[model samples]
Target: WDEEPFELIVSNPPYSVKWVGDGDATLINDPRFAPAGVLAPKSKADMAFIMHSLSWLAANGTAAIVCFPGIMYRGGAEQKIRKYLVDNNYVDAVIQLSGGLFFGTSIATCIMVLKKGKSDNKVMFIDASKECIKVTNNNKLTPENIDRIVDVFAKREEVAHFSHLADYAEIAENDFNLSVSTYVEPEDTREKIDIKKLNAEIAEIVAREQVLRSEIDKIIAEIEG
Candidate 1:
């Protein structure tokens, strides 16, 4: 970071990597993290990297960074940082990706899109967790899947069970939890079952079983006689 602002910033930093976050008392005074009024925990440097990218972002710039899901709803210092981001309208969107998309791990990850200048106070949440095709051991997003995500994000449209546009008030009510699942309702795909029909089928099977048992016993008795 040479103090020069960039129009776009993108990164996929290491997950939950430890850093000299709060451990260094003066680190909070740094302009990048100072706005949040608190530093990312030393154990989890996720937000710290975000702050760094945000600091170097231009006025109309947008930074899209992949992040661990925990930072979305984690409490304490992380919550405080999230509160700051939401209150300032720095967060543009949060996209949830499917699990098993990477090697060595099957944990679901999220993308936190940050913008210095936002057109609106609402934050868009896109749940793209189901937009992947299983490829060998990892899940891969096809071109169509990527296009759908990009289109929804660009349009900022709220699709039922897929995306949501949450206002600042709603975010405040939820304590600044930016988790996509919190905003976008996942579709319930489980098949519906009729209890009455199932019970009748079980009863019919039991009746057939009883009749077969009776017939078999009668045949054994006849043979013996």
Candidate 2:
């Protein structure tokens, strides 16, 4: 039996698996990894699957993969593979999902979208870490949340605090780090303070303290008398 090329591929490959050592050096010579010119470390096989999916990806197809967050920015062989992918303009978009979205673990994960034929020389990054509703035991992506993400992904627009489209040169300037957080800025939800209001409150508190001190002095004087 033979497998046919697919137009769309989606997978949640094993998080991190040791694929090298113990006489597994032959992986370095595999055709899928040979293009990268560097094999994913024996202790980490994330790139191996990535390369394999890419090898199987049709010229016009896209592969959406769920990947461990570490592979995006980790240095060494993984970094080398990332450099190759980014340099070749195969990466499409990277989306950062918030932690606690998956069951049995709360560690954040990311999605890597790869394409063989790209329309542009840039990569779209979506910071959807907060696009989930808290359920009983885990965070689940609501339909609205999913829609919001899909809309942004499809449009490839830079939505403030949500997404950013980074050019190849920008990626190279950053050393080919594919982490979504590296490109998409998260929303700052911290409350903004009004300096004038804060100072007025401080002054009111000081006045109350002075009045209390005056009352205490009056009590002391009466006792002395």
Candidate 3:
């Protein structure tokens, strides 16, 4: 608490405050967030924490904040604040995280990485929800998992169904929705079934049924005659 402001700031803050935001007369005009009298509900303070970090960030520095999924693409004050951030070209990356990764909660979370004076105009959305491996009781990001993500972040590669470098215009077109699934889709895996084998099995069943029917008919005729 005695040190001066640093070049970079990063933190994971609580999602809610258990308090009301509308009652706070000073929060509406806060220069850190949206200027449209928009402030996050005090109960859901994830955006508030993000805005605070953004305000404290240096001109050339970055802030990485972990937040709930709602803060990324919600309406009202959230959308306004998100608009302010994205419109200012401050958002760098939005990473979707796997569910069941954190203890005491199963709600899927997302990481919002904000950079002032970022090199790229487009924002990178990475869907790393599938990058986790199941541990004893929760999903965990392994060395490989973390490495793959870091590698992607460094290179900003557009790997199909994993990551996408979305243009700022495209993001605006989507009404500022920052959900990772909106940009990066998980890889689809499906095996083609063998219709030939299924047809053969059906034919064999029909043949067996006809043979049993013939045998039954002959036995009934013999008994009657």
* lDDT by candidate, in order shown: 0.94, 0.89, 0.84
Runs in model 3 with CA error above 4 Å?
Answer: 1-6, 34-37, 195-204, 207-215
- Model 1 reaches what TM-score against the true structure? 0.85
Q: What TM-score against the true fold does each predicted structure earn?
A: 0.85, 0.89, 0.83
Model 2, residue pairs in steric clash: 20-42, 98-129
lDDT of 1 by residue, 1-225 (tens): 585799999999999989988778898899999999999998999999999999999999999999999999999999999999888889999999999987888999999999989999999999999999999889999999999999999999999999999999999999999999899887889999999999999999999999999999999999999
Q: Give the range of the ten consecutive residues with the poorest summed lDDT in model 2.
A: 19-28
Please rank every candidate by TM-score, starting with the best: 2, 1, 3
Model 2: residue 104 alpha-carbon error in angstroms = 4.7
Top candidate, metric lDDT:
1
lDDT of 2 by residue, 1-225 (tens): 154477899999988987752246676688888899888887888998999999888899999999999999999988999999988989999999988887778889999999989999899999999899888878899999999999999999889988999998899898989988888776778999999999999999999999999999999999999
User: Each candidate: how many clashes?
Assistant: 0, 2, 0
Model 1, 109: alpha-carbon shift in Å? Answer: 0.9
Question: What would the per-residue lDDT of candidate 3 be over residues 1-225, giving only the tens digit for each residue?
Answer: 443244678798876655557777877677765453477776787777888788777788878888889877788878988888888899999988898888898878888998987887889999888899988778999999999988998798888998999998999999999989888876768887799999999999999999999999999999999
Q: After superposition, how far is residue 68 of candidate 2 from its true place, in Å?
A: 1.0
RMSD of each: 3.3, 2.3, 2.9
